[model samples]
Target: MAAGRSLPCDDEFLCAICLDVLCQPASTPCGHNYCKACITGYWDSRGLAHCPICKEVFAGRPQLQVNTKFRDMLEHFKSMRAAAAADEIPVGPGEVPCDICVGPKLKAQKTCLACLASYCEGHLEPHLRVAGLRKHKLSEPVSNLEDRVCGRHDKMLELFCEPDQVCICFMCLKDDHVAHQAVPLEQAHREKTAELRAATSGLKMMEKVKSSSVKDIKGSMQRSKVESDSDVSSINAFFSALAASLKCRQAELIQAIQEKQEAAEAEAAGRVAVLEQEVAGLRRRRSKMEQLLQTKDHLRLLRRWPSLQMPAHSEDLFAPEPERLSDNGPQFYAGIVRDAVARMEKAVNNEMELLFHEVRLSGSCEALKHATAAEDPIEDLIFRSMPKPEEHLRMIQRQHAVDVRMSKCDFSPGFVVSEDGTRLSFLEDVRFCLPEVPNGESQPPVVLATEGYSSGRFYYEVQVRGLDNFWVGVVNPAVSKKGRWILASYMNSWGCFDASHLKKLSLKRKPEKVGVFVDCDTREVCFYDVDAKTLIYSIAGCRFNGESLVDFFTRLMTSDDSNHRPKLYPVFSIFGSHSSSELVITPVSPGP
Candidate 1:
């Protein structure tokens, strides 16, 4: 039998049940061998049985024996395989063969100290027995032999230091390390042996921890990749759906625009066809009439009688009737052609006009007229006199009052209600006072006053006979009329009322009830209602004083005060300085 091959044994040595190897040898009466306890157990359990291998009858349990020879053979083979594997420098299971030494050689036995090269036993003879290489030390093959180097310089290391637990060169000990502790290579080897044993005790624990960490990191990366892929898929799906919807909307818009354009074109074409048809009919009728006039009968009559009797002028011939070829002979063709052309032109103009209705030719014309009318005084005056829109006027007044109060009073400008609660401060210089009673002696006054002014226009109004009687005048600086009176107020401070304050009153008949008075002297202006003698309102800001009274009065009479009514004076004066005079009340007769 081949040394490596497994051979079949005789039936007496073979196991009967497995048919290949006998686990424990047993003998039967028939001289056949079976596994110990195999045939005996079969027969003993059943009380009667034939031999499993030879069919020999076995009425009782068979004897059994251990197969020591077969067990020894198996152990020997395993030992040989393990020895052979150990002898070889076994690389990693799937590692590629070294390119330099492509074939198997005797196991690497020696390494060059200088070149750091490994050599098999066959190649190591020169380094061992040769006279020049006899001093080189040889070592058993180690997987990490390449890592041994001088501890300090990291060069090829031959010497080991037990004291430092390191490998070193002789140069290291002789140099800066001369005084340090040192030991022989043999002592270093013994120390390394103990260290290796200690390291090996915890090797399995380190490997397990390293393996767990690697598995955890790999699992985390795999999960992250999966989540990233899922996110990409979701985003792609969303954009695809959005793009599809946008495409649908774009198609819808295109269809709508196409339909609208088609309708517009169709309408335009229809109008053009109608105009062309009318023109064509006119041309055909003109051609027919011209052909009739050129006939032989008509020409001979015209040649024979130069002064032929013409038709009398009638509405059909003279009036501007619809142009037809027969009415005025050849001359009527021109009119017919003109009328047709005019109608066509008008139709085209109407179509164009409808197409551009938003275009304002009148606005352009007005702009041009305004640009050219810059020097026109009347236009300027008209523009100036045009009443501001009510909303705009209110806004301007509000802003003006805020700006004035913020500038003058040094107090934050805001609206405030009067103490009496009858008026609101609409602006810094303007107030709105509502009438307390509709038919009372006096309408409410919207007062306008400035601080520290002694003599100026004290303009106000009084209600008399259901009309406003406006007055403007100035009183003495000391607030007493008996003192030297000064001209102060005018209706509007034009140049004519600069020197003297004048008082002039006017009855406005259009509203049937208002009277205005302008006083250049004392700078007082007031308004009154004709049916009542009570003051309605006043404004006192006129700076004029010592001006010609008559001229000031003329200008004040002509001044425009359409928007503002007079501010009223309170019946009772509440001055802390003087309390001597009693309030005076006088009734005046109503004017006719």
Candidate 2:
């Protein structure tokens, strides 16, 4: 092999007939080796037998035999080439190299703990071939096989101490592990395997939970984006409607002022036209007189004067007095605009105060709307007025169809109830009166709902029209209506709008209809802009202190009152000096 190192591999290993490495080398009598298949095919093609290398002729087909020694040498050469190529390969990252391999070590496949050595596939072949070597423990490749042996005892760690939870050698059993619980390494491994299987199952379950949580979060984000778009649309619609209203009012005012100016101008123009006709007649008479004077004809001048008699001079015709424009006219109209604007501004101020105070009232209403519209027997009309989608998820036990009527006792003179007792309108120049209170406190004008509730949930709607500022919601039944009192002022009373005390709802645009919902069990009350279909505010987690049992019993015993639980009555308030609009209690249809 050393003498043949300089020879070309193609010349030494390749068969001359096939021009490739010999598959099954065969020798001819001429001493040339060729592939058995290649030489047979060549001889058959020509129908003659001859040595390809020497070209020696044979009388008949010469017998060729396999060159066993040459074939063995070729196989040895192929194996040596492979081994040399493997030696040139370098170790890569995260790969355990064979400890026994010299120079560039090959990647290890397994480690023998008993032998305290790791080996590549090539080096580990003997362990597989020899029965005694196979008995040595083998595992997945590891970098430090020496760590498996005990450092103190210099022996294989064959026992597991349960008490100390450390691996120990057989000698450690008599020393440090004598009083500790110990188990065979194999037994401990089996126990640990069972524990790991259980842990893997738990990890799989946790992965599923995390996946579900991620899905829920994605769903929430998508829903939030949709809701945000809806809110923007609703707000834009509200402002557009408001602008239209203001423009309509502006046009009306301008038309009114123009009508008055046109009427005045018409009268003044009529008087001026009459005066001009009289002036023309006078001028014609004067011209005739001048012509007569120039002609020296006294008779013609006298005749023209008699025929075109000059009208008598009158102070009314000559003075031409016209209606004068009042200096305060612009100021008066401007005052009207200012007053209207002031009312609107006040309404906005009150709404802003409510919005800021009830910052926490906002929540998802889409779920509640669906529950009512799809599942509950409540009418979808109740939800139609909602400006935004409901996101507040809660179990609706039942829907209450509450019938509210205006109470005369709590009504003001300005507020006129409808003949059917379902509507309330404000009339101008009417002074609202409060019934005499048992206590010294004054009462503000407020209309109360005839019906009351002490427990459970109730919902209702109020249609607000022709008024910019109006309040609607529930209040305690015991709230005073004496001289003057603020809404939601008393600790027990609650209402949607309470500029004097607490605010329940903040509105961006004046809603035509408002919805009120109260959940006594949850101690929550919510108000909605019905037309916009959005939540204005919510009063949540309301708590009330009870007086003594005797006092509570005394109130409960009253003939008209069966339940002493604080009954909530629907209440309303309106601002502005005069308004024709009414705060009507609209009918609510049950959802199917």
Candidate 3:
């Protein structure tokens, strides 16, 4: 007996002799199924008839025939297994997935032009079987099906309106394009293919021009480098004969000229890099077009024609020339030599003290002006407000990083608060005893941060790892454990909502770390998905004025003043059904 494959196998589908899936299965009178050849060979070897499973001997040999019904069923099962295996591949990177698949979309094998949907082999079986779908054109998997559709009509662009010079749908023929001349998509594809040759030829020419431009830029850089190196060598020789002060000036001049040469060469190198990239891109596109042209299949050529990405190129295809290296080294050296001679003469006379001081301060004054501009309050504000994409959360953390500590109020037992007031967790099978609200005696599993915000902006992050359902937001600081507080609803989706107003922002994924940002000036309380660096929700025009002053305070610490500013303290807790209720006050930190 042979072993079955990795997939789960049923005894009914397996042949007793072969042990693998039944192939041309034949049933015996003793009610046992086996491969036709296996059963025939078994009886022939012993010259006797017997059931392989039950060992029941037969008097005479029976004629063998293929079980047509069972064979069909076996084939059907094999097909199903094959389909399942084909659909094992989900939508991975760079894979066009079947839009029809519900979950973990399967890799697409074909794209239907008429349906405008990609389909895996399993899902594509229906189109192969269905008579109506058989007529619809299908091509190799294409990602951009939307591009094949007519934007105006919202239908597959099957025709080209000659007058308007645009792709149009069948519906357009009886509507906007009723009076205009139109042709079949394939006809237009053939016409365009002829024109495509010219277009691709132009691309080749562009590629050549850009390549030449790159070569020219690199050549210029090489020449400039050689000239600059020679100049530097001459300066080194010249400066070796001068005095210490004169030598210092000579060194400065050499460094300046070398820096200038490097800048110019780097600019040329950068231009060459861009031109080379464009040239390579053009070659790839031209190669794809050439391959398409070689294919004799008109339908494939037509289908792929739309997918060919042809970037717009200006009539002047040449790359811009890099900035030329100016011959400033000789001029600068000459000026330095004249200044050195004049300086010695002036010091001997000692008559231009004020003028010397003015000359000394000229460069320093420009640098000081730049520093003053950078420190301008208005400029700083604008710069801070407009942070780069994905840097929004980090910028907020940097600017408004606040210290958060879990306040240990007199809320009985069952809940564990860390010594430093940074962590909060619940005991096994033990519920927390939190604040008793005004309306009801229901205690929420909530804890407040020690630090409170009354003015300006504040941001803090809470590590909610090991917990599923939780809420992290600003709450009114309570005066005591039994003081007044609003009971916010258990939110599965993260968002901002309050007593007077409500706004919800649905979260796409569960985040391990959650950041809370509060801006008093703008009156915005925003929640951030820290790892994703995305703003989960924000409530604008929010007035966070809590009545309870003692809701959060340093435990046994000295504070004689009872009067405190109306501030909202950061709060977090495990709401809804959760496996773990632990929460950690994460210190604000920058991302790698």
Candidate 4:
């Protein structure tokens, strides 16, 4: 072994205190070798001189002399090991470097718990070969080796205190944590690994659930696209049919005018032919009269004039009175055209409203317009304002009309109600810092008309022209405005927008004006589409059932009104967050 065989086996070229290939190796008086600074530091830090391994106390501090021969051997060993494993990768970011490597650190291969150091394959050779080091624990390379050491005891934390739920050194178990249940670090690691695996299993389950939800969402999207495409095609066909009808009607009108012109020309031609015949007769008579005048016979001229007769079917000539005929010609057709146009406009506007109603299913009015962009449409706003009388609504308006006015003090903040209570509008820029109303802290602004109905049938109309997320319902005056929000058409029913026991409804037309009629005797409420003359909805057998729940809450939030008669009042709700449209309580009038 070249006279250095004992060096590797006895670890003579290593430091006992620093536990690495010795730098400036020094010999102690006790026949041990250590790095010179390591020995001096050990003594200076302790203020005593002693062997760390053997614990042989000295009477006084001993001088540490450099072991030149041992240090030369260590340098030789280090250089030889470095040259042997020179092909290994150098340590890079995120990789633990060998603690004992002299120059650029090589990637660490193993860590030693006994030595508290990481080693590359070059420096790890002695640990593998030495019998004394074989018993030391070896692990995968890890950075921050000091974290595994106990802070207070300065020993390797090799155990876990179960009661304390912390990593502890063996000395800690013997001291402060002596009575605590303890487990070997490997056992605790195994248990923690099991827990991690369980958590991973739960995460995998959640991942699968999320994946399924994503798949469902994708399917819904596909179905919506299909439906949208179908609707677009249907709307295209409808407009094409409509345009065809208009074209056909145009042809009919033109043809009628052409026929009328042709007949009038024929009538004038007949009258002109008759007048020409009469002129030829008068010319012949004049020639005859001239000859008679030459014969000096006045009696003959008079006789000839008497024989001259008026043309047949001629109008009166003496006074020449103009015919008093009612000329039902082009003017008559003009009235017809005007009437046809009015009917066409009404029907077309109604169909256009149907498109907005389709938004609930399509989820977007803008998307629908884009989807049906193939038709160069009439401007959308023109159709939005069209309205005609509805039969049921008009009847209700005439027979059951009741005056409704909003209460200024009763309405929630962030809203402005008209002095007459006919108009309701929201504040656009600010959330109110005003006084609290009865509906304080309840989201959105609410307004209930001052008029309440407890008996008899009554109807009122609301002009919901530009409103969104608006609710026009009858609330029981007996309960707080919060309760008996009996009905609403809340923004296509998105997100908890529903009446109690509400079911989905499909409207063919979005009503611009709505009429709500209540019959207390029958216990029934009916909503009317004012323009379409259609019953939007009707809820029968309504029991306010308001009193049952109001008394259960704390007195601060409760109002004892269980025994009061449930008188329903008109309620207008505007979710100030989204709605900006104004509502109008319109005056109802009878249909002519």
| Best-matching candidate per TM-score | 4
- What would the per-residue lDDT of candidate 3 be over residues 495-585, giving only the tens digit for each residue? 3455344455556787778788877655577777788888776666554443222333441145632344356777766544342577889
Candidate 3 displacement at residue 558 in angstroms: 34
The residue ranges of model 4 lying beyond 4 angstroms of the native Cα positions read 1-86, 114-116, 126-137, 146-185, 205-235, 269-315, 318-339, 351-459, 462-592
**lDDT (Cα, tens digit) per residue for candidate 2, span 1-592:** 1222333465788888778889789988878889999999999998889988889988989788888898898888777766556454355798888887878777787888888888876678878879999899898888765777899989988899999999999999989888898999999999999999999998898677656655665676678779879978998899899899989988998998988878767876887798699789778867876766786676766676665554566455567566664444778888988999997886676455445434434545455453334232444565455432532211111134467787866676667777777877777666343322213344447787777777766777788655555556776745333111122212222234321234543346766666777776556777766666667777565531224445544655765543446777887766443456566788775332
TM-score of 1: 0.25
Winning model by lDDT: 4
User: Which run of 10 residues does model 2 get worst, by summed lDDT?
Assistant: 482-491
Q: Which order, best to worst by lDDT?
A: 4, 3, 2, 1
Model 2: lDDT to the true structure: 0.67
Q: Model 1, 1-592: lDDT tens per residue?
A: 0121232323534466767656655556786666666766777776777876566675555455655676565455556655544645533543322212345534455566654556654455567668877676655554454577765676666566545656677778886557767666677778778989889866766666556645654665576578668977997898799689868975885586567667767876777797698669657756765665667796665664533333354233355744332223335545675787697676556445433442322232333234335343554453343332232222212221110001122222333334432222333443223322212343223222222123212222222121122112222333222212221111221111112233332323312222333343345544443343333334344433333447556656888533222222222111111112111112223222
TM-scores, one per candidate: 0.25, 0.41, 0.31, 0.43
Go through the candidates in order and give the C-alpha RMSD of each one to the true structure.
Answer: 33.7, 19.3, 44.1, 22.4
Candidate 1 displacement at residue 320 in angstroms: 19
Residue-level lDDT tens digits of model 4 in 1-592: 1122223543655577877878888877788777889989999999889988788889888877887887778778876665555557689999999998777888889999999999887778888889999888899999998898999999999899888899999899779998999999899999999999999998898677656655665666687789879989998998899799889989998998888788878877777797698779778977876676687676766777665544564344345644533366887888988998897786566445445444423433443344334333563453344343354455567657888898888987778888888988877664422222223444345788898877667888899766545678687755553445334555554221212455456777668888888886556788887777778778776655343333323421655534444678888876533445678999876667
| Colliding residue pairs in candidate 4 | none
Model 4 residue 538 CA deviation (Å) reads 2.2
